[model samples]
Target: MTMCPQCGSTFLQPLRCEAKGSDVLLVELRCSECQTWTKAPHTRADMKELDRQQAEFRATIVDGYERSVAESMEALATCFGHALELDLVTADDFRPRTASA
Candidate 1:
C-alpha cells in the first residue's frame, strides 16, 4: 500500500494502466483526498511547458544545493569582510607578560 504523498493518506488505488513499451508498464495513480491523477511512466513530457516544469522538478536537489552553497558563501564572505574591516588579529597580540622566573 503506497501512501499518497500529496495527501499524506494511505488510501491510494490504481486507476488504470497504459502500455509504455513492450516491457515497460505505466500505471495511473489516483488520490482520494485531492482527487488528482498522476501518470507513472519511465518519463513523460505532455507539453513543452509541462516538460520544462517536470525537468525543473527533477532538478530540485541541485537547485537546493546550489542555493544553500551560495548562501553559505555569502555569509562567509560577509564575516571575513567584517573581520578584515575591524583589523581583528590572533591571540598572539594579547600574550600575558611572563615574569622572569
Candidate 2:
C-alpha cells in the first residue's frame, strides 16, 4: 500500500493478499527495486491497483514471449533453407517410417 521506504520505489510485488473483511485486505508486498518486504492492511482500491499492475506485467511478458517465439521460428526457417541448399536434407528425411515384423 505504501512505496518502498528503502528505495522510494512503487514497483512492489504482492507476496500475500488475503481478504481480511468485506473491504479490507491483508497485503504483504516485496519491492522489486530494493527487495524490501512490507505488510499492511489495504483497501479494495489498493487491490484494484495491484491487479491492474499485474495485468500490465502479464501483457508485457506475453508480448515478449510472442516476439521470442516468432524470432526463433524465423531462425529455424533460415536454417532449414541453408540445409536444403547444402543438400543436407534429402527425400529420405520426409519418408514415412516402416515397422519391422
Candidate 3:
C-alpha cells in the first residue's frame, strides 16, 4: 500500500472506485496519528471502475479460478466454456441437507 505524502503516517485507509474502468479510488483517509485526510487511488486495469463510493469495503479474492484468467489464458477459456453448461436451479427445486442428529 502506498503511504500518504502529507502526514508521513503509515496508517492509511485505502479506498477504491470502479467507475473509471482503469483506476480504483481511495476516497478519503484520516491519519491515525496526525489526523490528516488524504485521497488515494487503488487501480485495476482489468475490472470496470465504480462511480459510487461504498463504505462496506469488501475485499475481492482472486482465487485459483480468477488467477487463471490472467496468468494462464487458455485455462480461462476452457473453464468458461465448461461453466456455461452448469445447471442452475431455483429455490423450489433445491434440496436441503439432512441433520446428522
Candidate 4:
C-alpha cells in the first residue's frame, strides 16, 4: 500500500497508471484521506500487493460500519424496552390520523 507522506494514510487511489516499459509501471497516486499526491514506479507484483492491501482496507471499513449499525440497533431496542416499561408508548400512538386543515 502506498502511504501518504504527509498524513501516513495508506488509502491512496491511483490518479494515473502508465507503463514505464520493461516490467515497470509509473503510478500517480492520491491519498483519499489527506489528498496528498505522489508518483512512484512499481512492478506488476507490487501493483497486485497494493490492490490486496486496498481490498483489506475496504473490508475493515465495511466491518466497522456493520458493527456500528448492529450496536445502534441494540441500543435502540433497549431504549424502546425502557419506554415500554415506563408506559411511554400507547396504542393511540400507532393509530392513523385523518388529514385535517
Candidate 5:
C-alpha cells in the first residue's frame, strides 16, 4: 500500500504505470483524500523486453513511412507518364532550375 506524500493519507489510487525496463516501474498514483498526483517507484523485470518492444515499434513506424513515400513516388511517376503520353508537357520542360548566384 502506498501513502499520499502530501496529506499522509493511505488512500492512494493507482492511475497508470510506465515501465522502464523490467526492474523499475513509474507508477502514477492519485490520492483520493488530497486529490493530488504523485509518482511512485515499483519493481519489475529486466529491460530486455522493454527494449525489444521499443525497437519493434520504431521499425514499424519507419517501415510505414518508407512505404508511404514509395507509394507517393510511384503515383507521381504514373501521372508524369500519362502527361507525357498525352503530350500535355514535354520532357524538355522538366529541366532543373538553376539558382542565381
Candidate 6:
C-alpha cells in the first residue's frame, strides 16, 4: 500500500502507463486527496522519448510566438504608414498615456 507524502492518504490511484520502445513502462500514481503524482521505474528509452516530446512541444510554442510577433509588427507598420500618409504625425501621438492623465 502506497501512502500519499503530503496528506498521508492510503488511496493511491493508478493514473496511466507511459510506455516507449517496448520494455519501458512507467506507471503513474496519484493521491486521491492531495493530487500528488508518483512515477514507477522507467527505462532509458522512456526518458529519451519524454525528452524528445518536450523539445518538440517547446519548438511548437516558440514557432507560434514568433509568428504572432511578426503579424503584430506588420500590422503596426501598416498603421504607421497610413498615419504618415494622412499627415497625422505628432510627437504626443507616440507618447504613452498614464492612468492619471
Q: How far is each candidate from the true structure, as Cα RMSD in Å?
A: 10.2, 4.1, 13.6, 2.5, 10.5, 10.0
Q: What TM-score would every model get versus the actual structure?
A: 0.38, 0.72, 0.32, 0.79, 0.49, 0.55
Q: Which ranges in model 6 have alpha carbons more than 4 Å from their true place?
A: 1-38, 94-101
**Model 3 per-residue lDDT tens digits across residues 16-97:** 3334334554355566667777655555532122221222222233355576677678876677667655643345555886
Per-residue lDDT over 64-88 for candidate 1, one digit per residue giving the tens place of the 0 to 100 score: 9999999999999998889878988
Highest lDDT: which candidate? Answer: 4
- Ten-residue region with minimum lDDT total, candidate 5: 45-54
**lDDT per residue, candidate 6, 8-44, as tens digits?**
8855666777665468677676887889998776675
lDDT of 6: 0.75
TM-score ranking from best candidate downward: 4, 2, 6, 5, 1, 3
RMSD of 2: 4.1
1-66: candidate 4 lDDT, tens digit per residue: 467888998888988899988889999889989888889898888888889998999999999999
By TM-score, how accurate is candidate 4?
Answer: 0.79
Q: Order of candidates by lDDT, top first?
A: 4, 2, 6, 5, 1, 3
Question: After TM-score superposition, what is the CA distance of residue 47 in candidate 3 from its true location, in Å?
Answer: 14
Best by TM-score: 4
Candidate 6, run of 10 with poorest lDDT: 45-54
Clashes of each: 0, 0, 8, 0, 3, 0
Task: State the lDDT of candidate 2 residue by residue for 1-101, as single tens digits.
Answer: 64777898778888988998999998888999989998899999987987887788789989999999999999999999999999899989999999988
Predicted structure 1: lDDT: 0.65
Q: How much is 6 displaced in model 3, in angstroms?
A: 2.1
Evaluate model 5: give its lDDT. Answer: 0.74
lDDT of 3: 0.50
Q: Of models 1 and 4, which has the larger lDDT?
A: 4
Cα error of candidate 1 at position 6, Å:
9.0
